[model samples]
Target: MSRRDIVTAIPTSFHADGSLDIEGSRAIFRYVAQSGNEGAFVLGTTGEFPAIDEDEFRALVAAALEDLGGRMRVIVHVGRSSAFEAVRRVEIARELGAREFAALTPYYLASAEGAVESYFEAVSEAVGDGSLFVYVYPKRSGIEVSPALLARLAKLPNVIGAKISEMSLDDIAAYRSVVDDDFVLYTGADRDLVAAGEVGAQGVVSGVSSVLPKPFRALAAAADSGDSETIASAQAAVDDVVRIIGGDMPRMKAALRSMGVADGRSRMALVEPDDEALAEIDRVIAAYR
Candidate 1:
């Protein structure tokens, strides 16, 4: 992958009962691959990494690798609160043939800049030659990656980039101005992919891609072809549709289910979106189409 390909995070498909639906997950993976996206990230935020067990994670990666069969680049997000666990996941991802890896700053209990550096170092040491990108999403993990910290970490032999999940357009531009060319700056927010791209985001790390791969891939292709109009159209379509679902994750799952892709029931602890919510989402998508 030329680092220009849009990289989408794959969500683990779950059955109605909330069990890992490996087959469903594979189907979704195939869907994304066929959509012409450059690559997909397995076991990341949208994959419900925290709720999934170690065995499930292994199985999910193995299944995706088998299905992808080198058709698309596979980037694994091996971040966990525990550095050891993150390293272990990195090893598993490597064993499954994943060449790209991303690790978020550990969540909760803010780590001193040194501790954050140490965590990436431990993961880097474990995953040897695989390309690595720092995953920075402070809202979920109270830790942020400073430009200075990112610059220091980018010097690590195998660390190639930082996945900027929270940086606004100006912030992204500021970081881009300071970072070296070899260091990638992948945008984390799906909704801001176009803005990110305009400011030189290498690619997108999107949760919305789990369901709407076609649109996301379209935006990516536009960026590659230098076609701003097409990018705007695709991004607008997604933003308009996602409006009805808004911040309700359950509704997002329900919306996908309504389209015939089962993403397992929104895991326990989340209230499933009711029929009314689904109708609103349907209406939003229908209006745009």
Candidate 2:
């Protein structure tokens, strides 16, 4: 069986007034590592990267590397609307000894044809010899990365792999068909780890795994061993986690708070769960325990 990686898309902790919570962030890093995840995909969608300012971004990168640098692989997301800014983040992470980086296609603007390739080219150049993964999330990036585009980017020496988020297994299979055998693929859809693996994806960059990782780890294990019963059971647990979080950062933070991992505050305009929702979240967490 092939190796399977479960890298958690962790959240950036913030105080009530929206200050960076360094210790809280470190605690999350420790929690994920202790839970047996292979890596941490820091400062991605789940980390609220778009809302984070320059200094906050640096602090998060430093904190993550400090906490988990040697213990596990830390794939820092340095994606920005500006390739220059993304390059700057990549330089910062490199200065701090980060070896793995991921960059999203430039967003919030209508780029001409080939702009996405150019953006990745700039970031990959900045990365030098370090590994870089193309982050393809069309729903948020306002751009679609076709498999052909990925094929072109894959030619870049440092462009080693990609994280395909909010996409279908068919999409993954399409991507798998384009890239070479060594080029890695990871799905952002948390519930489809086993299926994605079956389709040639080596891993997952799962947001749901940040708050609840055991099921994800179990699912990866089952995938590795090709254990049908365990895969079904672990997938069910992951589904329950997805249902509880409902793909909302506020609820994810709420679950983390209940788990005593991090506080439930966000810089984004996300609404926290109210009475009924909070009660359900708590009940579900209790049942999981």
Query: What TM-score quantifies how close candidate 1 is to the native fold?
Result: 0.89
lDDT of 2 at 191: 86
Q: Which candidate number would show the highest TM-score if scored against the true structure? A: 2
Any runs in candidate 2 off by more than 4 Å, and if so which? none
> Whole-model Cα lDDT per candidate?
0.75, 0.86
1-289: candidate 1 lDDT, tens digit per residue: 2345567677677877878788778877776677566778877777778888889989988888887756888888889998999999989888888878888889988689999999988998987888888888888899987778888888876888888875688877877777797578888777766677667677777766656566665655665666768767877876865566543556656666667765555554677766787788777646542
Using all chains and alpha carbons, the TM-scores for the candidates as numbered come to 0.89, 0.96
Q: How many residue pairs of model 2 clash at the backbone?
A: 0
Ten residues in a row with the worst lDDT in model 1? 240-249
